[model samples]
Target: MDTSQHSMHNLFEQLGLPSSEHDVEQFIRTHRLFSQDIRLDKATFWTESQAEFLREAFEEDSDWCEVVDELDSRLRS
Candidate 1:
């Protein structure tokens, strides 16, 4: 298996949250998106630093972008 893909699956950990899949799912389940039209970086659940990290990762198109996008998709879903 590609290890990079495996790492992408741990989106919560990439965002400095618990690494476990269960914890990640629980966190997603509990958090609400600020609005359906709002981006993940604008979501109310994250701290300012967390939001900044996400915005930077996305703007830079860094390796973390995929995971961050995944988290955004999951959260919005």
Candidate 2:
């Protein structure tokens, strides 16, 4: 892999997060749901949307969580 991809991959693995370029890009695109920052990419996204969905699901399975999971899953595929 190129250094850029390797660097992005290592960073996510270190954080115990998904690191594939596609997944990372997806997570970054949806990050506005969690933070004020708009800038995101494979190099900076670390949080797992699936984990986030599960946490919110604990509050009771809402449509929002379902949508979130579906969105993330779609991106992962």
Candidate 3:
């Protein structure tokens, strides 16, 4: 049983990205999803492993889902 809470910072860390608030904001600002049709895991900026993690998180509705979804939304906007 895994019972850990995750935030955007944590999600970035898991994805091997910079985990600071400023870094996350900078990433989101630069990586805006140009098309609504593009899935978060399919975004070109993500490395294969990062994409897989996001895919699995959403597919499993795991503990990481909320923050992953939040990141998805942020990148789109």
Span of ten consecutive residues with least summed lDDT in model 2? 35-44
Off by over 4 Å in 3: none
Best by TM-score: 3
Candidate 1, residues 1-77, lDDT tens digits: the string is: 33465354465665678867678778878885746789888877788988998899899987778878877777777
Candidate 2 residue-pair clash tally:
0
Clashing pairs in 1: none
lDDT of 2 by residue, 1-77 (tens): 33232244554454466889886676557653443342222213435663553456436755344444454344444
What TM-score would each prediction reach against the true structure?
Answer: 0.77, 0.34, 0.95
The residue-by-residue lDDT of candidate 3 on 44-71, one tens digit each, is 8889999999999999999999989898
| All candidates in order of TM-score, best leading | 3, 1, 2
- Whole-model alpha-carbon lDDT for candidate 1: 0.76
Q: Rate the local accuracy (lDDT) of all candidates.
A: 0.76, 0.47, 0.91
Once fitted onto the true fold, the runs of candidate 1 whose alpha carbons sit more than 4 angstroms away are: 1-10
> All candidates: CA RMSD in angstroms?
3.3, 14.0, 0.8
